[model samples]
Target: MPINLFKKSHSRQGAERSLYLAYYFRTPTPTNPVRYHTALVVLPSPSPIPLAAAAATCAEPQSDESESLPAPTQSSPTRARSPGRATSPLPYVTTATKFHAFNVPVNENGRGRVTWEFRVERDDPGAPNTPLRLRLVCLLFIGPLSQNVGDHKLEKILKKTNVEAKYMDEFPKYYCTNWMYEALQLLVDEKIIDPLPCSPPDFWEVGGQYADRWMAENHLQVPYDLPIPCCDRAGVALATPMGPVEEKCPDDETNGNALPN
Candidate 1:
């Protein structure tokens, strides 16, 4: 059975902020190569009131006079609503995960080098109440992996050197567990967190199809009016005259092949 490796660290003060890195991996199969994925979990300062609870509290029946008033113009500034108490603090805590995929080539000896970088940014740096604002940039290097290499050996290597690594799993449908393992080295080097064992969140169990269906069913609005594509798997397979070919995630029509700068 596979287990999730999770370690977390907390800030010394104010609203109780926390950060953790998770790692997992998928072994190679006849049709697919070895892949890894990562989750950088950040618990920012919680709001005094959860958005849903606040909305419920503010919900009121419309009056006839109010209904008769004209709708506000598009150019008019909207008024901010006052915060209300939430029955539970869980609703006030927000979680966001950024996904990345990596495909590595292993030699006959089943060894390969993995290199990658990840940049983590806080939602609001200027807010007075914001807890973590440092821009974390991690460059990773994991020498190689083979059948002979065990978790203990890997952990030792990570402690000696900090490296950064992402990708999806096949059967269990977990994101970048392998990359998360390697990224722990970064936190270790920075003295932010100590390695520990914990279960991954249920939210991490997802794929392209699940994401698309959930968002569509919820009638959620994506920022910048971007269309969300269903990525059934990590890479897209295209057929040419020669043979079938695989490529990176398909290009977004609005953004082209370039990732956001």
Candidate 2:
């Protein structure tokens, strides 16, 4: 859970807005005691932005490279791309579970990083108090649009918590919010985050500890045979652990399927 949506409508340009999927979870990392990870960031602008610039907007540590992403600077927001790469409008970037922080990188020259033709898998280590990991199978950009009032109301409960306003904005719009909600719902429907309410983002605020307590109290182990979501698209098979190591794509699928392909 901890699926909080923060909206930051382009302060000046309302249509050119950004939605952030702020995910606060506890991990074993010492430096990240209370891991406040932004699982997914949906910046559905009228056009694309530079991947480097988009990456720069994030303040949280990047868990993709096994090292922290360089901080963004006013002069040069994100890391500079190698020569021959053209910077333009960017799409969305989703950092799934820590297992493989960023399964897909933003297309340096394409519209986005992920497409609709992607698969979602839940990997259970089969350990107690251990939550299953969410994996994004495709490497393209999937944009978001609109806002969901229902979710907006539900997150009101989190206001009482110390979670800052800057953390909870009007980002992640409806499309990205719903997409992430559905993904988390899969975990709820599967009973992974059971014995604990899985609906509210507040529940997930300290979800890591909650899951640990549940595991100790019930002696439950994360099962491996979870009902996962997968799809197939012609010419684009699901990538393996070590394949497609490039950022730029020749055939862009930024505007892909709504659901899995």
Candidate 3:
């Protein structure tokens, strides 16, 4: 499938660049279903003038449904609890890149299992802009379908990937786009990796500031240890009639009132 996005960064209007990325996951059988999450972060390239030039000149059609998706505000089993943003240790990609992922389940009986695929492409394939190239990183997360982080099944799946040598032996030492901090805890608990590598104090100060601002405006979260301010609770627990009864709070007994006090 193809996705389209518009590039509107004024600063890069004079430069030209384009990037194409394809990421995919495979399963042993079509019957195996898994909950998978994928992310793409565009870091600062050593030089970005060509990219800027390409973005400025590239023109493409937009999707009939061109609206951007809403950010995730809570956790879920079937989808990402957080969304990724475009930024990084270096300058971020200013042009809009059309990126999308699919979790297709193939099954004979209609009870299909899921596989992950993420693809990113430029607006103009024939443009003379610099080709967008960057690193692709991977992490193992704990989800409803992927609850067993260290399961042999997972190890087998990971080994199947043609990742670089560093990723095979040590924990990821680089950065994240949009991440759920809690997932990192799960990774640590499973002994998948040690403490996330730390950057120098000043570097973190600058990077974290830029990243946090980018994330807030974009409604995304990085899967790192940095603390995020919790949203205020509504204090109203909602339920449906067909749903289970709400558990009575101890305060309800003390107040001698019903209806959840």
Best by TM-score: 1
lDDT of 3: 0.23
Judging by TM-score, tell me the better candidate of 1 and 2: 1
The per-residue C-alpha lDDT of model 2 at residue 225 equals: 25
In order, candidate lDDTs are 0.26, 0.25, 0.23
Positional deviation of residue 28's Cα in model 2 after best superposition, in angstroms: 13
| Model 3 alpha-carbon drift over 4 Å, by segment | 1-15, 18-101, 118-210, 216-261
Put down candidate 1 lDDT per residue, 20-102, tens digits, no spaces: 22222223455343222333443332322111111111122223342132222223343221111211122222432222333
Best by lDDT: 1
Tens digits of per-residue lDDT for model 3, 1-261 = 111221111121111221111111222233323112223222112122112212211122233343332222333123211112211111222332323332333453685443333344332211111121111111111111223432343333333332322221132221121122323333445554333332222211222332233343433321221111110011011110011011222322121111000
- After superposition on all C-alphas, the RMSD of every candidate to the true structure, in Å, is 17.4, 21.7, 21.8
**Cα deviation in Å at residue 29, candidate 3?**
25
Write the candidate numbers in order of decreasing lDDT. 1, 2, 3
lDDT of 2 by residue, 1-261 (tens): 121011111111223332223232223343223333323323233233112222212222122333222221223333222211212222223222221122132453764443221222232211112222222221211222235422233233222222121111232122222334454444334332222222434333332332333233321221122111110111111111111112323432223222121
